[model samples]
Target chain A: MTAVRCVDLCKTYRQGEVDIKALDHVSIEIKEGGFVCLSAPSGGGKTTLLNAIGGLDKPDSGEVYIAGQRIDNLSKGELAELRLRQIGFVFQAFNLIPVLTARENVEFVMQVQGVPAGERQRLAHAILDEVGLAGLEDRRPADMSGGQQQRVAVARAIVSRPALVLADEPTANLDSKTADELMELFRELNDHHSTTFVIATHDKRVMGYAKRLVRMLDGRIVADIKQDAA
Target chain B: MNLVFRLAWRNLWRHPRRTWLTTAAMMFSNTLLVFMISLQFGMYGLMIDNTLQAFTGHLQIQAPGYKDDQKIRQTVADIVPLAESLRAELPSVSIAARGTAFALVSSEERSYGIAVFGVEPAYEPDVSTIPGLVSEGRFLGDIDAPEIIIGAALARNLRAGLGDELTVLGSGRDGSFAAAVVDIVGIFDSGIADVDRSITEIPLGLFQDVFFMDGSGHQIVINAGSIDGVAELQSKVGSLLPAGQDLVVHDWDALQPGLKQAIKADMSSAFLMYGILVILVAFSVLNTQLMSVLERTHEFGIVMSLGLTPGRLGRLVLLETAIMGALGLVLGAVLGGLVTSWFSVNGFAYPGMEELASKFNLPARFFPQVSPLTLLVGPAVVFLFTLLAAVYPALRLHRLQPVEAMRAV
Candidate 1:
């Protein structure tokens, strides 16, 4: 089943008198459990496309689907509900709430979801352990290193066991080894839990870990290639 | 639910100085308001009490047209019985029968037109301050003593002293020539210029006899309790009056119509000053909350992106405001109460206030009321205004688009 499908997505950004097309007639589909990388250089629309798929941005003209439900025309509230329940997002910078510790950050979404405190705590602990942050659950984002903060952000995004995780340059601030470790964790979640991932990155090392790679140039897809299983 | 609280509380300390500055503004303003309001009420209480004590004793029972027409003949019929009945029915009150006459008081070389009150010596001190304010010599002697207590200023004007003979001349109740020769038993300085210059008190029996009335007196004055209790006490006194006696009750405000207007005007000006202080504190809160929201744009975007709704984020900001407001309100009220109580106990007085107070026979010290309403009303208003000030900033989050806010630096 299709986890995410965007048909002819179009988005534009205006700077003073000039209009820049961030996404133009971009179309893509990812099946459940698919590990895909959206590879693009600066000004090539990867972040815009990721934001559109996560319902964080509304495309000027497009139809977005997660698990076969049309999402383009949904109200802001409905879109928030869809993102809260079905999708998780990891941003490149400023991913974790500064005031929340690793464990509390993981529990943030579940708290909003009205999960009981005990259950939320249990899930938060388990997710932090899975992300190799068990001993650092109480450390706020500011106290953690860049890589650790990213890991905490990743844990928070995936803690609720959402079906699709959309990440925009998730490993941008991390060292090489930390980036490799994070990719390995993403692959594990995809293989073991059937959780699909759509990562937007410009890093060539990141593209190598994807089972499917989509490359874009000036907002249009130039290549969609499926490689051997990682 | 607990996590939300944790988030809101911890978020406040992120910039401790800013939070404290905002909270301090509210606290300081609330403190000033509480202190000022309490002191104002206290001074007003003294002002009203002293003003009323000059002649009116909170409430008075008089013949139907006596207040409108101060003719000596418009006396409450059977005033002694009526005063006795009031005293019996309301034992908590100070009731006194009075006969009043505008007469010529001549002593030595001075002959001054004075308002003479014929009062019961025993009950006069209970209902009026003139008896207690005797600056030299003494107040009028027992109910039948042929003596009068004139104000100190009157004494100065008359150049009279204790045991000096003073002549009183007035038209009698039946329009006959009423005259008397009395000794100056005491002189009072009631702080009030009018009372000091043109008033004297003699025993009711001597006054009625000298003024040619057999048994009638002009008024039966009663001091029930504090001014706050006057309405209820007035009603109680009205019920106790024997029906169809041609006697009616009048509260101090009705007897002195200008007094209520003076209080209203004074309070209006005071509240205007207090209102300005509150508004300044509110704007201070607005500045703090807006800065907080603006600086947290990226953090808010991250939360919203993580599936927390914008509405929930807005509410979280409001929760933050409420927490801060509650803190300021509690601290401010407590501090304000403490300071007011300290001042209330010690009493506050300005340099020239003593001289002004002495005129009305008022005490030099002003005590703050320090009641629950006075303490809470100011802080409650500040809390509400702080919340109101925060609403714009909190609601500003509702218009925040997660994608754009995420991109904000």
Candidate 2:
């Protein structure tokens, strides 16, 4: 099954009297349980494409589908519901809610989904353990290191076992070893749970972990290549 | 809802100093409102009681048109018997019969025109304070005693004193020449210049004989326990009157027309000041909540992107404000109530209050009327205003674009 698809997406932004095309006629498809990496330089439109796919932003003209459900035409509330139920997102920085503990941050989505407290607590603990943050569940984001905070954000993203995960520069603030460990965790989750992964990055180390690599320049796709796992 | 509440409560403490400062403003305003409202009401009660009890009793049964015009012929016939019947029916009330006429009283050296009231000597003290306020000599003794008690100012004007002989001259009810020689038995200094300079009292029987009243009197004054029960007492007195009698029962407010209007005007001005205070506190709340919302733009964006609706986020903001408002209300009311209750028991007096009170026949200290209404009404208004103040901040969430909000630093 095709887990995510975009057809002829176009988006434009105005920067003080100049029109910048963030996305131009971009089209891509990712199959179920696929690990794909979108590689680009700074301001290369990778984050914009990820935002469009997650329904966090709308294209000027396009069709976006998640798990075969068209989402580009959804209302803000409807988009929020879709993201809560079907997709998980991890941003580069300021991910976790500062007021919540690590475990509570991980449980936020399920709690909004009306999960029972006991069940939410159980799932949140399990996800924290899986992310190598078992005993640090009670620490707030401010109290944790950058790597640990990113791990908490990653735990929160996949805690509900969403069918698709969209991550934008998830390892940007991490050290080299932490970035490699995070990529390994993403690969392990993808292989074990059949969860489709779409990561936007420019790092060669991150692109090496993908089964498929798509390259972009200035909002247009320039290359598509398939490779074996790292 | 529990999760929302939990998040809202935790978020309020993110900046503990700001929260406390806002809460303190609300608390201080609420406390001031409670105490001031209570004290104002208490002062009003004292004013009404003092004004009413000084001369005009809580209620009076008078001949129709007699209050507006003091014509001697317009009289309540058999007022003594009527007062006796009313006293029997309302055992808790003080009842007395009286007749009033404008008379020229002449002493050995001088003479002046004064309003002379004929009062039941036995029951006069029960209904009026004038008998108790005698400064010299004694009140009238026998039912038919040809004696009178004059105010100090009136005595000073007539050059009269206790035991002096005075000639009372007035027109009788039958339009005949009324004249008598009466001995002054008492003099009272009521501290009110108008009442003291223009009023005197004589025995009801003597007034009847001198004024040709023929068993008719001008008014039957009744003093209930307090001003609070005046309306009910008036109604009871109205119902008990004879069906054919042309008499009217007037409560203290009815008899003193300017009194109610004066109180209403004072209240309007007081509430205007109170309104300003409440609005000031509301603006403080607005400032705090607005700053809080602006500071957490990115966090709000993250929560919105996580599937929390803008409506829910707005409700969370209001919830935080409500928690803060509730804290102010409870703590302020408790503290205010304590302070007001102490004053209510011990009485409160300001500087020079004794001297000022002595000039008007008023009590030196005032007690605050601390009831539940006085305590809660002010705090409830503050709580509502604070909630209203939070609305603009809450509505700002609906306009947020998650993509843009997440981009905020």
Candidate 3:
């Protein structure tokens, strides 16, 4: 089943009477539980497409659907509810609350969603273990390695069992070795939990882990590639 | 909602220095405001209590026309029969009758102007404590002996001591020039400079002879059986008295306009100071909260993006402010109470300006007392101020757009 679809989506940035088209007439669909990568060079509008699909930005004109709901038609609050129930996000910046420990950062999403305290703790600890951060539960983001922080961010994003995970340059700040490890963790979660993953990245290593790849340039998709298991 | 509160608490502790400094500023202002107001009230209370109890005795009564005519001899007839009737009418009351006249008191070397009070020594002790404040000599023994008691200042001015002869000359009620030789039997100090330097008390017969006054007293001092029962008793006394008679029955508040005016002015001044302190504390809290909110713009956006609703964020900000306010106010109340009690017990004293002190007419030792409301008011005021401060931050939280805030960097 298709979990996300964009029909001729357009996004523009205005800078003092000049309009820069970040995404123009772009359209794509991702199946449920699919591990997909949106690959493009710098300024190719991959991030803009991810931001629009994640409900963090509005398209200038077009349609976006997530889980059979018309996302562009939804109000901000409704989009927020949809994100809370069905979407998880990992950023290139590892946007963890600096004051919270590794496990607490993961538990924060469940907390905001009003999960019971005990259940949130239990699930947060479980996700941290799944992300191979089993014993570093109390270490803050600043105290962790780049790879560990990214894993913690991933654990936080997935702790609520979200149906779709959107990762923007998840490995952009990591060493090649750490980047490889993070991709392996993503691959593990995808295979084990059947979690659908949507990654917007220029990193070849990140796109290498995806089972399906869509290539973009100048705000429009140029190619779609699918891979079969060995 | 609990999660919002928990997040707010954690956020507060995230920057401990800012949190503590803001709380300290509010706490200091709260303590200062409460202490100043309570001390002012306490000093006012002590002055009123002492003045009413020791000097004025709560209320005074006078013949209908006599207050306007305090001269030793006036046209109003002697009202002794009416006075005795009042005594019977209010038997449980403390009452004294006195006649007042101006006279020249001389002791051979010097003569000074004096206010002569004519009183039945036996009945005077129940009203004012003039007899109790004597530092030297003794009170009048009998009406026929024609003895007088002078204030310490007057005694010094005339160079007269106990048993010294003093001459009093004044006009009699019948317009004759009256003169008498009297013994200075006592010297009393009532702490009021005007009263201490000029008042001289003589036996009623001596005053009546010197001024040739009628038999009735010019002024009547009355104390109800209980302070609480005064209103009812005054009404009863009024009903028993003759209508159209020239008399004045005044309560304690009416007796001393100076003291009442001072208290009112001090209370208003304290109220104004408290208002300014509240505003200052509110601004301090608001400034700190606004800074923190602006700094955490990106964090708030991230939380919002993670499904933390704007309402939840707004609640979180309010909850944090309230918690800080409650803690700061609690500390202020306890500290303020301690300071109030310390001042109340020790009493601040001024020693240098004896004349100025007397001129201002306030007591040398100022004792500040605490009311129950004094301790409670500081915390209530701080809480109110803090809540007002939270309004801006709470609004900022509610209006935050998740996408824009996340992009704030």
Candidate 2, after superposition: displacement of residue B15 in Å? 2.2
| DockQ for candidate 1 | 0.75
Model 1 segments more than 4 A misplaced: B107-110, B210-214, B359-361
State the DockQ of every prediction: 0.75, 0.66, 0.44
Q: A-chain TM-score in candidate 2?
A: 0.98
Model 3 C-alpha lDDT per residue in residues B1-409, reported as the tens digit of each score = 4545666788898889989998898778767866776777766665665566565666667654544455554422355466567788888887766777777889978999888888768777777678888889888778657788989888778888888899998777777887889988899987676888888888876676567666666766676643566777767776776777666677777667878898888788878877887888899889988988888899888877777777777777788899899878888877877887898888766667455545554567666667778777767887887988989888878778776787786
Please state the CAPRI-style docking class of candidate 2.
Answer: medium
Clashes of each: 8, 0, 7
Point out the higher-scoring one by DockQ: 2 or 3.
2
* Backbone clashes in model 3, listed as residue pairs: B42-B369, B63-B246, B64-B246, B64-B247, B65-B246, B172-B211, B173-B212
Docking class of 3: acceptable
Provide the TM-score for each candidate, comma-separated: 0.94, 0.92, 0.77
Which window of ten consecutive residues has the lowest lDDT sum in model 1 chain B? B354-363
